[model samples]
Each structure stands twice: as C-alpha cells, then as structure tokens.
Target: MADGAPAAAATDETALRRDLAAAYRLIALEGMDDGIYTHISARLPEGPDGQKRFLLNPFGLRFDEVTASSLVTVDESGAVIDDPHGAGVNAAGFTIHSAVHMARHDAACVLHTHTVAGVAVSSVEEGLLPLNQWSAQFHGQLAYHDYEGIALDLGERERLIADLGAKNVMILRNHGMLTCGRSVAEAVKLTLNLERSCQAQIGALGMGLTPRPLSDEIAAHTAAQYQKGYDRIEVDGRPDPEWAALLRRLETAAPGYDA
Candidate 1:
C-alpha cells in the first residue's frame, strides 16, 4: 500500500496517478513543456487531516521522463509532507501552484507551460487575438499577468491570483501560459487548446497577412460554446471518452504515472 492509502478505499488513487503521468507525457508530446520549466499539479482527495493537498512533478525531471511515483506531495503552504521517492520538487513550482490552490477551490488541477508560441503570444502587445476558432474560444476569458522575474517571490501569489480573477486561462505577459481545470484531464485539454491557438496565431501572423477578427458577438458566442462544450463533453457528460482512452494508452506506454 502507498503511504497515503486507507484501510477501505473507494476511489482508486492509482488511476489518478496514471492520469497525471499521462498528462505530463501528453504535454511533452505537444511541445508545451520547456525543458522542465512548467508544472502540473492535481489536488489530492481530502484526508483525515483536512489538508487535502496535491501531487506535482519533481523538479529537474523532463516532462516526458516523469513517472507516477516520481511526483511529490505537498501541502498548501508549499511544504512537502511526503518525499518517499526523494524526487525533489521546485520551490518556484510550489510557490505558484500552492498560491492558486489555496486561493481558488475550483482549481483542482493547475498547469503551467512555456512553449515558444505561448511565450511569443504572451509577449505580444495585443495578447491573444480572436482571429481563429481556437483563438476565439479564449476570447473575453483570458487573464494576463505581468512578468515578475522567475515567480520565486512569495508576495507574487496575491497579485497572480488577482490577475487570474475568475478566468480559466491566463497569459503571463512576457512569460508563458497557465490554465486551471476541475480535473487533470480538463486542465491538460485546456493547455493543449491554448498552445494550438497560440501556434495557429503565430503561424498566421508570420504569413504577413492581416487575419480577419471575429466580431464581438461571435467571439462571445464562441467562447461560451467552448466553455459549455468542455463542460458537456469533457466534464459532465463524458463526451470525451477518447481522453480516457488516451490515459490508458499512456499507462501502457509509461506505466508508473499514477504511482
């Protein structure tokens, strides 16, 4: 039994571990991770202690190289409560994730990535543009935070939260991107969409062509469609069984993600 296992468990912790691990690999495949720069974390189930913490990737491990047992558990205060595998986690990662987790209850899983497109879009003067379907989905829903040098300062948490507001997607100006979801799958999906959106935008921009922008009404409608679409398909109605299948595939390919 794992260190956090209970005598009679209903939920399978191993499944969660696998899901998280699969997410890491998927992010790597999508080119969303930047050489161990980003982090993904899932909130653990509530325990007797009421801490109800999370598990995050170990520091220095490349996204593709991360395994389930390699994750480290920590409390909201950024302190490691369990380090059985001795997989060191980054203090900066903890600082960002713990702040969001502590401030927002809906943020069950927080994902951050530093891809070329994401960083490029973040640094753009206008931020994300609603020129494409992928970009339009984030219209009126994206938050922006100014870069504050490496995210190591504890004081940045409050401002980060303030900038995030109620949005699910955030662009760290001159930095990268952040997305929060009720589950690891949803978070991963959001990040994937965001990355693709940025990539598409950048590709379009490079052509030296002025792209057509969606009207405010259309952008709003599209954004609502995405929010409701994800809720109905990915979140509530099991509309995305493929994501579950992908998780299984990940287990076969990289078996120890959920450990």
Candidate 2:
C-alpha cells in the first residue's frame, strides 16, 4: 500500500483535471460561452504556506477546450503564480474576477458570460422581468451596473463592487451578465438559470404578444426558494454533494478538464 501512494496521488490529480475540463465542455454545450470572452474561476485549496489563490482559464482558450491543468493559478494582484500553458493572462479577466473575489468572500467561484439573449436583455431599459418561473427566481436578487467599456480598468473595481452590493447575480448594463456562488457548481448553475431566463424572455417578446407577468407574491416566493437553495451550503460552508457528482459526470464526458 505504501508503494501505491504515488499512484493514488496521480489518480487524484487526473480526476481533478478531468472534472474541470468537463465543466468547460458542459458550459459550451449549454450555449453560455461567448467565443473566448467569458471566464470561470475557482479558488484553489489553501496551500502549504497558508496562502489562498485562484485557478482561472487561460486568456485565449475556448471554453470547450479548457482543462484543469490549463487553468492558471494567480494571486490577488492577478499575477500568475503557476501556468503551464505559458499563455499570458488577460488583464480584464483579472480585473473582474479579482474585484469580486476580494470584495465578496462568499463568491468562491465566479462565472461571467456574454450570450446573445443575455446581452440583449442587458441592453433593455427595463432589465430582467418577472415573466415566468426562471425570471421569478431572480426577482429581488439581481443587481445592475452601467457599462463603462471593456473591464480593463482596475479603477472600475470599486464601482463594480459597489453596484454588485450583496447580490449574487449582476447584469452589466449594455454589456453582459455575471453570477457568483460559493462554489463552482453553484456559480455555473446560476449562470445557466440566468441564461435560460433571458432566452425564454427574448423568445416570449419576439412573439409580439403581451406576455403575462407573475404576481409579486408568487415571484417573491420563487425567489425566496431559489435563495434558500444557494444559501443551504454557501452560508454554512458545507460542500455540495451534487456539485461533486457533477464533476464526476464531467469526468466521464470530457476526460481532460483537470489535465
């Protein structure tokens, strides 16, 4: 058994790599990825030195092709501490993720996307509407921030954090949508729900018929339920078993994510 320890460690590393790779593939399959623009990041486990860092996708890689090994570890300053691919990290990616992570400790995993429906809804003056169950889930939980060009300015972090406030989901007005969660699974799920809501809303609007809006009471109730689901673990610091299962599923589907 002693001789097998190294092999076991290697196996564990491979599993993590495959799981992360699968996440990227799943994101692409859901149509939430926008070329090479969006990013998803998770904080690394505490290191030997008791330092906490994060893992992010390389700057130019497509979401579908991102693997766990391809993820670059960076400090709070956005400086890459470990990157095997040698692909320089994007400054804007660092600006956005760093600000949110620093300001909100609850946000262990951050997912940002620029889908067609998401960008379209962001451009609308009314913002997200409580037209159905999906939108209703975000009734009182969504925040909006005005656009200020590409997110390359570190100075914008203050305003971004200010607008985000305590909300988990944010619409970057005229830009895109962002979701943060206590873990990568929750963040990914939030983004998926947000995208689905936007797609459904846009489809409803294009029909040219007056869409029915949910009653305030119903909407509030639905939003409460959704919050409860996220809060069940986020606030309690408990690991989500469902998220672990998801990683395993991804491993089966795309075996190189963590590589």
Candidate 3:
C-alpha cells in the first residue's frame, strides 16, 4: 500500500495486485464500471503468521484510476492494513467481498458490477436465462441472492454465503451481478461474458417477442465445455493467450496499473 511497507509473500502479492488492478481498469475501460461503486478484489496468499487477507480497491478512486500500489489490503475482518492510501473502503464493498472471501477460500478474485443490463437481468424473475453461448457457461452455475438492502450489515454475510453456495457467479436480485474466479483473468473473463450475456438477453426481451432459450441439455453441455477450458493456449503453464491479450488491451487503453 505504501512505500517501504512490508508485503506478505511479496512476489505472490505483487502479482495478484497487478492482476487485480488490471481487472479494475479493464472493467472501467469496457464501460462496466459504476462510478466508484462496484469493486474487484483478490485474496492474498497466506503470510508467515497465516493471516487471511485480500486486496480491494481503495474507496473514492474510480476503477480506471486504480494502480497495483493503490490497492488496499483487507484482513479477514474487512479492516484495511498497511493503509498507505488511507482511503478505507466502501462499506458495501467490504460486506460483499468479505462474505465471498471468507466463505469461498478457492476464490482468488471476486468481481462485482452494476451495469444497466446486469441489473435488468437481476431484476428479472427468470435470472440470467441460458439463451446464448455466453450465458450458457453459467447455466446451472449461477446463484441468486435476494437483496437485503445496501449490504451494510455484516450479519447478512451468512445469508449471502448460503445463497452463493458452490457457485462461481451470482445475480443479486434487484441489484447486479457478481463473479469470482480462481484467478484475476478468470474472474474478468467471466464478468465480461456475463455482461455480454445480460445485454443480449435485454436486447432480445426488449423486442416484445418470445425468445427461444437454449435447451437444458445444450446448456449443460456448454457449461461442461467451459469447465474443460476454452481458448486456452498455454505454453509451459504461463499466462493463457486470452489473459495475455486482455492485459495488452489494458496497456493500450488504460496503462499504469502495474505501478
């Protein structure tokens, strides 16, 4: 967070910071951002003392303005440590992210967005219809959590976790979308696909015509394919080509996240 501040597992934390910052910028660049409202967060590897923590964008900074060094480290209790920016964090961000980070240890990064289409889909009773390939990937993997208001209550974390059980993505009813991943790249990719799928659904529904949804069997098969990995061109286990391309896009569009 600050110069000379001690970082737990510096190498791993540094990499996560860059990746998380890049996700924030990409979201903003793609017009998926909601001012400084939504948050993208990453879980930090354990330190020597085995303290559980995660990185979240400091409150008040727009996603496009986020840099690797500007991210804040939040402990398991949602308190910011090594507060370099001293910006604290949005209460809703802490509540939502803390819920997932605590309940889902496997989620290395979590992305939340309030895009118009996303909110529209969330408000729908059907919730993220599996009408397209982009949406099919989450056919049965998407969860739904009823909005209990502004998410300021820490007590709501339990209900949130219960609603999101064993799912990688969720639609907060009357709110927006949330996605978590084993990596930042995965999280961003899922969010991108989710947003596209939402937009497509909205467009289809706006036509006042009955839309043909993907068959349940097809949706299941597509979700399986995604689980097997798609567009993954890995060489010696380095960054996947899809992720590399995304980073390059960020570099050209909104650089300086690695700072």
Candidate 4:
C-alpha cells in the first residue's frame, strides 16, 4: 500500500502536468502566446492538509518547449517547491494567478495572454462589444480590470481580485486578457472564444460603420442557453467532444508535451 501511494501521486501529478503543458502548446499553435512571457498555471489536487500547490512554466522556456517534467511546482506564495533547475517564477504570473487562486476556490487553472487582437480590444475605450455570437457568450459575465503598470506591485493583487469578482473571464484594460476555470480545458476554451470575440469586434470596427449591439435581454437569453446546453457534459471538470478533440490535435502537433 505504501508503494502504491507513491505511484498514485505520480500518476495524478503527471496527468495535471500533461494537461497544462498541452494547453501551452495549443496556445502557441493558435498564435495566442506572447513569446515566452504569457503564463498558464494549474493548481495541484489537494493533499490531506488541504494546502494548495501550483504548477507554473519555467521562466525561460518557450511555450513549445514546455513538457510534463519541465514544469516547476510552487506554493501559494510563488516560491519554487522542488525546482531542480533553479528556474524562477514570473512576477506577473505570480501576481495574477496567485491572487485568483487564493480568492476563487473554483479556479483550478488560470490562463493569461497578450495577443494583438486581445490587446487591441482591451485598448479600446468601449472594451468588448457584443457584435456576434461569440461576443454574446460573454455578455454580462466578463470582468474588466484597469492595468496597474507591470503588475509587479503587491498592492495590485487585491484590486485585480476585486475587479475579477465572480467572472471566469476578464479583459485587462490596455493590457490583455485572462480566464479561469475548474479545469484546463475550460480555461482554454474560454480563452479561445474570448480571442475570437475580440477578433470579430476588430473586423466589425474596420468596416468604419457603427456596429449594432445586441439587446441586453437577447444577450442574456443567449448566454443562458449556452450555459445550459452548449456547455453540457462538464462531468469531472472536463467537457466532452471539444476537449477530447483538442487533446487529439495536441497529440498530432506536439506529441511530446507529456514526455
């Protein structure tokens, strides 16, 4: 039983590491990454004491280079737990992810990005407008936080958490975007949809005509339908069909992420 316990722990850790690494690779494939700067973090399954530990990418590695073994483990304070390579955690990652994981117990994974489309939408005075189906999915659920410089200051953590509130997705004003979910699949899916919404709004604005906004009542109804049916099959924190297909895509493009 003692020997089996160690094996079980290793299996759980490997599964989470692979899921997180796959997220990074898929983000890179979708051109949503900001070189080696952006981060995706996952909280470890709780132990007997119930203290949480998180997994973060090594500071210097590109998203394509991330693998199950290359990930570094850290505590709630962002201190490396058993990092053999001496790779340090990113300050921005620590500040943003740590703040959310501490505040929102439901968030098991947090993804942050700075893509051209995302930042372009974020810079606009009117934030994300409901110009299409993708935009309507967010509707009233998306939060917004004003960029407070580089996010290195400890003081910004509280403000960021307050701005995020109970929403799963947020647009960092003049910065970029962020999303959290009960699983990596959920977080990645939200990021993909948010990015598409931002891209569509940009294209609509390019037409030089004032884009029509959806009525609040209509938007609310659409969001409710999506939450009830479109997001069905959220069993075990993993959505079927889409998430299964995404993992297959990752296998073909970046097969060694779990290695």
Candidate 5:
C-alpha cells in the first residue's frame, strides 16, 4: 500500500507537470508572456504536516523553454525542494503566487501575466469594461489590487489576498492581471478569456467612439452564463472539450512541453 501510494502520487504529479508546461507554451504562443517576468504556478500535494509546496518555472527560462521536467518545486519559505541544479524559483514571483495558493485552497493553478493590453486596462479607472461576451465573463468576478512596486516582500501577501477576496481574477493596478483556477486547464481558460477581455476593452476604448457598456445586471448574468458552467469540470485527465482541443492543438503547434 505504501509503495502504491508513492507511485500514484508520482503519476499524478507527472500529469500536472505536463499540463503546466503545456500552459506555458500556449501562453507564449498566444503572445501573453512577458519575457521571464510573469509566472504560472501549481500547488502540490500537501505533506503529512500540511506543509505547502508549489511547482514554478525556473527564474530565467522563457515560457517557450519550459518543459515538464524543467519545473522547480519550492515551499513557502522560498526554499527549493527539488532540482538542486535548477536556476531557482523567482523570489519576487513567489510573493504573488504564494499569496493566492495559501489563501485560496481551491486555486490549484495561479497564472499571472504582464501583457501590454492587460497592463493598459489595469491602468484605466474603469477596470475591465463588460463590452463584449469575453469582457462580460469577468464582470463581477474581477478584483483589483493597488500596485505596491515590486512584489519582493512576503509581508505583502496579506494585502494581496485581501485584495483578491473570493474572486478568481484580479487587476494589479498599474501592473498586470491575474487568474486562478481549480485546474490548469481552467486557469488557462480564465487567462485566455481575461486577456481577450482586456484586449477588447483597450481596442474599443482606444478608438475615440464612446462605446455603450453593458448594464450591471446584464453583465452579472453573462458572467455566470460564461464561466460558472465549467467550474472545476476537468477530472482524471479528461478536460472539457475546449481544453481537450487545446491540448490537441498543442500536440501539433507546441509539441515539446510534455517532454
């Protein structure tokens, strides 16, 4: 039984690594990455003592360079658990990701990005405007955190969680955007949607025309309509049809992530 438990854990972690690696490649493919700045993290199985650990990219690797075996494991104290040869996880990046992982147990995957559109929208006073279906999906689910320079201090984690509250998406004021989910595919989906929302908002507002925004009631309805159906839907390697199709696309477009 003990041996079987270890083997099963290994198998589960292998699947997670593959999914996370694939997410990195997909993000890079979509031009959502910011060199090596932003981060995507996955919470690992807890220890008997309930110690938390996470899998994060090595500090210097570009998103496209990430592979399943190249990820590094780290604990809350910024200690690297595995891969002594790793470039080490980014200390500043850990501050943002650890805050979400520790507070929101349901957020198994946390994705952060510093895309131009995301940052542009974050800088605006209105936040994400529900201008379209993609934008409406985040209507009430989006939160905001006033930027506080670089996220190098562990002390900031408290305010980060407080700002995020129960929402799965956030705009780091003057910074970038964040999205979290119970599965890697779910997180990827949220990131893609949120990024699209920001892009649309910027593109629309960039034009001088005063576009009509959705009514609050309608936006709320659409938010639920768009995302609530897929809540934690992926299981046992069977993602929803959308995520399954994405993985298939990766097989052809970005093949080496699973390696």
Candidate 6:
C-alpha cells in the first residue's frame, strides 16, 4: 500500500491525476484557458479516508504550470484534503463543480471554461443553434442554467443541479460553458466539441447570411450517431486513436503534464 492506501485505490488516483493534468495542458494548448481561472476536475475513484473527494488544479497555478503531482484533492464540500503546494481552490469553482459532482454520481470529471465564443453564445437568447455538425452533437443533450451572479452562495447549488438534470453539457447563461463525463478524456472531448460548436455558431451569425439549420429529424439522428461514436474509429469504446494522437502531440508541445 502507498501511504496506507489500498493498491487499487492508489493506482486509480495516480491515473486520475495524470489524466486530469493532461486535460489542463490540452485546454491551455487550445487557448481555451483563462489564466488561473476556469477549472477541470476529476472525482477520485477512491478518495482518502474512503470519502468522496476530487482532484482539481491548485488555485494559484496557471494551466501550463499544473502537473500530476500538483493537483489538489478536495471533498465534495470543496474543502481541501490534500494539496502538496498548500494552495486553495477558487470559491466560485468549488460552488459550481461541487454541485454537479454531488448531484451526478456518474460524472467522474467536470470541465468548465470561459472563452469568447462560448460566452458569446451563452449570452444570446436562443442558446446553441444546430447550425453545424459540431452543434448537432449536442442537439438534445445540452441544457441551460440561467446565470445567478458569481455562484458564491451554497443556496444556488440546487437550482444549478435542477437546471442541469440528466444533461451532459450546459450553457451557464451569460456566464460560460460546462460539461461532465465518466472520464477525463470524455469530459475534454465534450468541452472541445461544445467550444467548437459555439465558435462555429458565432462565425455563422457574423456573416449576416441566414444560416440554415438541420431539420429536427436529421439533427436527432445525427446526435444519436454521435453518441454511438459513428463516423470515427474507436478502441475500447472510446475515440482512443484520436485521444492517443492528441497525447503524442501533447508530449512534444507541452511535456511533463503527467509528471
């Protein structure tokens, strides 16, 4: 046992740290990060003391500075349980992520971001339009939560959860974007698709040409195919080939994320 942790638990924690760190680095590489703000968190498969805790980037480190060893562990309440650098978590981050983690047991990882494209679509009244293939992926799978200030109060957690019921992606009205998944890779993939969809919508809207949307039948069919990982090669039921290629790219461009 490592540090009194069972062998299985220790292994799971190690993998989570490396994967979460890699996610942060990938997001930074894509220019989706907003300095030290925004967060990507993974729930520990087995937390210390047998309680539910998650791994998040330390509050002070930039995304590029985050590493597997530097990630902090916090309970569902967002209280720090283990932080090698003695750093705290952002309060607003805690409020938002904790609500999802507590409400959705299947959500092993949660990714949130603030990008120009994302915020632009979020502020609009109609939300994400099914104007492109990327947008179609979220046809019936996305939800929206009206913004309620800066998300500092614990009282707002219920509303946040309520608004996000059974949905994997959410637009935080006037705020940004949020996505959760059963793994770090899945969460990151969702973030990438959502961000790209928002960017495409913004661009389409900018052209002043009325963008034609996919019909409801086609959109729903496309969404179903996407859920099945259609039109792409897969390994072990995930887009492993693409994910592996991404990791190779990350290894050259931004090394040591898994340190």
Give the count of colliding residue pairs in each prediction: 4, 9, 0, 0, 0, 0
What is the Cα-based lDDT of residue 107 in candidate 3? Answer: 86
lDDT of 3 at 89: 79
Better of 1 and 2 by lDDT: 1
Candidate lDDT values, in order: 0.83, 0.81, 0.86, 0.87, 0.88, 0.87
Best by TM-score: 5
Between which residue pairs do clashes occur in model 5?
Answer: none
Model 4 clash pairs are: none
lDDT of 5 by residue, 175-244 (tens): 9999998889899999999898888888888899999899999999998877657753643444489888
Mind giving the per-residue lDDT tens digits that candidate 2 earns over 33-126?
8888777777665555777677777888998788767877788777888888889577567788889988998887788888899999999999
lDDT of 4 by residue, 62-164 (tens): 8988888888888888888767446786756678899999999889899999999999999988999888889998999899999889888889999999999
* Poorest stretch of ten by lDDT in candidate 2: 12-21
Q: How do the residues 137-231 of candidate 6 rate in per-residue lDDT, one tens digit apiece?
A: 99999899998898888999999999999988999999999998877888888899999999999889899998899998898988998877722
Worst 10 residues of 3 by lDDT: 230-239
> What is the Cα-based lDDT of residue 69 in candidate 4?
86
Which pairs clash in the backbone of model 6? none
lDDT for 132 in candidate 1 is 83
Residues forming the 10-long window of minimal summed lDDT in candidate 1: 4-13
Off by over 4 Å in 4: 1-6, 47-50, 84-86, 235-239
**What is the alpha-carbon lDDT for the whole of candidate 5?**
0.88
